[model samples]
Target: MPKEKRPRIKNEDQYEALRDQGYSKEKSARIANTPDQVASKKGGKAPAYEEWTVKELYEKAREIGLSGISKLRKKELIERLRNH
Candidate 1:
């Protein structure tokens, strides 16, 4: 029988540590995969959501698995993203 291959999880140690600290699997993976060191060194230059266009907001919301996306207004999408 062939041995099973381990799952490919980047920053696996940090991911497991975050899980132990009670972060959801999705959230943990997001954080673990983030280029935190690079971002902090360069600083996050992304504009705030309030400044983004409604279409951009919709795209961003959909990318993060927001539900009822087709029904959510731009304002509601912003709120959900903020609180997400």
Candidate 2:
């Protein structure tokens, strides 16, 4: 026999119907909350790490005796600074 297809649910009411019929909570949540609808209101931006100025990075590098400060990228500098 051919398999029965599940209906697409669009909103909270439809989700509640599915839940009442014994669908898993995970599945019900998925149907109710799409990625675009559930995306963070912070506009999907990651938090910026505390950035050190070039001079500050160099000073920190020197303070910690890091030998490769001049060749390091900003991220690398931040990592090295953190480790120190």
Backbone clashes for every candidate come to 0, 0
Tell me the tens digit of each residue's lDDT in model 1 across 1-80.
98446455678898889889987777777777877676368547899888999999999988988888788877888998
Flag regions of model 1 displaced more than 4 Å: 1-22, 33-36, 82-84
* Candidate 2 per-residue C-alpha lDDT over 21-82 given as tens digits, one digit per residue, 9 for 90 to 100: 88766567675766554644454463333544777777878886879689888788888765
State each model's CA lDDT, in order.
0.81, 0.68
* Candidate 2 least-lDDT 10 residues: 40-49
lDDT for model 2, on a 0 to 1 scale?
0.68
User: Over all chains combined, what TM-score does candidate 2 have?
Assistant: 0.37
The most accurate candidate by lDDT is 1
The top-ranked prediction according to TM-score is 1
- The TM-scores, one per candidate, come to 0.53, 0.37
